[model samples]
Target: MSEQDNATLIEVKGLYKLFGSEANKHMHLVHEGLSKDEILAKTGHTLGLKDINLKINRGEISVIMGLSGSGKSTLIRHFNRLIDPTEGNILVDGTDVMTLDQNQLEQFRRHKMSMVFQRFGLLPHRTVLDNAAYGLTVQGLSKKEANERAVEWLETVGLGGYEKQYPSQLSGGQQQRVGLARALATNAEILLMDEAFSALDPLIRSEMQDQLIELQEKLHKTIIFITHDLDEALHLGNRIAILKDGELVQDDKPEEILLNPATDYVEAFVRDVNRARALTVETVMQPQICRITADSISDALKQMRKTDDDYGYHVTDDGYQGIVSQETLEEAVRDDNGDDALCEKVYEDIPIVAPDAVLEDILPETINADYPVPVVDEEGEIQGELSREAIADVLSPDQVPEEAAKASQPTAT
Candidate 1:
């Protein structure tokens, strides 16, 4: 798919799974929806997952998070058909994974998706080189090509020199690197990571997260990572889905979940987050924009100076428009014609941006760009000013207090 196609990559509809036999006392409870007591009374088996629905997008990272036995792992396992949904539709890239026959399901699992698990599943008997190449080898490539690809992935995963070593010779982190190499070698568009770093030490886990970020940047692959750690979810997920008892309680961008969790359970998960770092331009950009034509530079500048904002300004054929800035005003003033000295100046090109850009995030762009960047609508119309000072103010710890104190005191002429 092209980069612009933000279509759903994976979709799940009302997925459900239950475990029990006819003699299981919980059989009646299963009809009512199994509770702990009902399951214990009816049969020993527990309900692993309940109805769950989710969608994953193309080329984005979505994290699934929950405590142990919350059905997180069980839900992810259903993605590649490792566990089939008892009654639901799982559409992977538009194909119904649940509807796939055994042969088709096997082919889909082998080729369409790749997985990384908490335990590094490298072959004990095989050399690291062979273990890394196992996926390609199974795909019917020649030994030479598979090894070549394996070596390439080894280098990709930063383990270039350990190709011939056995699994026993590697550290836990190193073995996981081998597992990562094996997963990437498949070149699957969708990657499923099931607590891939949960087994590593804290420091090692952090390092692995860095590596994962780097890999995602380079490959732009769509990923679904499962973890119980809220901090890890915040650090790595573009969006997160919180599951409890096989149900998705919350699925949203990290900031949304942090700022407004759906439940106390989810709120507890995000209570300690550093919210400022997680926010983006998409959240803080001003909604109001003033349109400016080339001839109305002075007016635009005056508006900008009056508002003390630098966002949502534009230069259209009618006149200069957007978030006003002194710089924009000055540029517009420079375009003034002799006949309308106050209105004539016109700036041909104006920088434009979305309203959601946070202060610090947008300041450097405006400071370095040719003009005050115009906060624009999705269609590129001037919406507001993206001011450097606004960003600086937001980044400055004492800005609010200083501004308040100054405002409260009389100003010197």
Candidate 2:
């Protein structure tokens, strides 16, 4: 992509959608500050969306969330021109979608975008291979080329050997995988998923969410996901746009929406979800932390003593390897080993997690660990560490540990 395309792939500007012919005739009533109900009563047009504006950045998951009538699904349809906006325009890579003629729009939908629907949208009689290859075949690829790409994507989505099975033969989750593979096989830059995982069972839905995140790490397609579930939105979205009664109420990163809700309605939604599910280790990890190598036990002990600390994280050019503690230092001295170099080999690959592993994803990993859990990035770089004490401080500001609070105060700005 060019620099401009990288910034904002899709931009929605002052969009409005009303479900009635001659909707423009009712624009004056909308400008009169009428509510959705009032506008409907007066103009006989249902207000699907009102003045919605959002910018979807390249290679990021942008989730639009709302209840049934809040216009979440309605807004997503405008991106592919599946349903044109009643007023205003949408821009894709700075090209106004409204300016595209029938052929241009057809090409745009065929090559530039692919959509996954709530109902799976698979042909009942077609085999999984045929369904997955349908998008590429529609673009006029040869049977052999389309099937090869379809086979690759079906395996990518964990449906490797199920190529000959029909959609009805698969479970709801497996069928959804077929839907996802079909969408992915097209290899469109922008992926529109309208409640793609909503119909699955709860456990299956969670699995699908994890699969999407894992796939996104490698592919990084510009994804616009629609969900009414707040937890799903928080787990998947890089930035969330929340709608209430067809108007965008708040647009923010997951943490911002949790820590500072823009309105009472947003606050109400946040209150229901336990914040731990929405927050990851990256949000509250302590970045400016003690870094000690495995061979520096004596030096590390001195540094920890000066700071009145018991633990230190070990990192190298290869990035965060593991952690060390005072107990390990004591063991080192008791062994009477002058060389701490070989001690590194003893416990180089230790993975520890905690008790409430299912109830809450992050907190237990911090609380149950012998020391603070190190926060590693996608590339295995050490960004910071997350601890029970810090989580406590965040949850109960009035009872902050003085040392932890003091250490983080500098970066509060």
User: Which candidate has the highest lDDT of all?
Assistant: 2
Candidate 2 stretches greater than 4 Å from native: 1-5, 289-365, 368-382, 395-413
| Candidate 1 Cα deviation (angstroms), residue 396 | 17
All candidates: TM-score:
0.73, 0.80
Candidate 1 per-residue lDDT over residues 198-261, each given as its tens digit: 9999999999999999999999898999999987897899889999876789999886887678
Query: What does the lDDT read for residue 389 in candidate 1?
Result: 41
Task: Pick out the ten consecutive residues of candidate 2 with the lowest summed lDDT.
Answer: 350-359
Mind sharing the TM-score for model 1? 0.73
Clashing pairs in 2: none
What are the Cα lDDT values of the candidates?
0.73, 0.82
Candidate 1 runs further than 4 Å off: 1-6, 22-37, 288-413
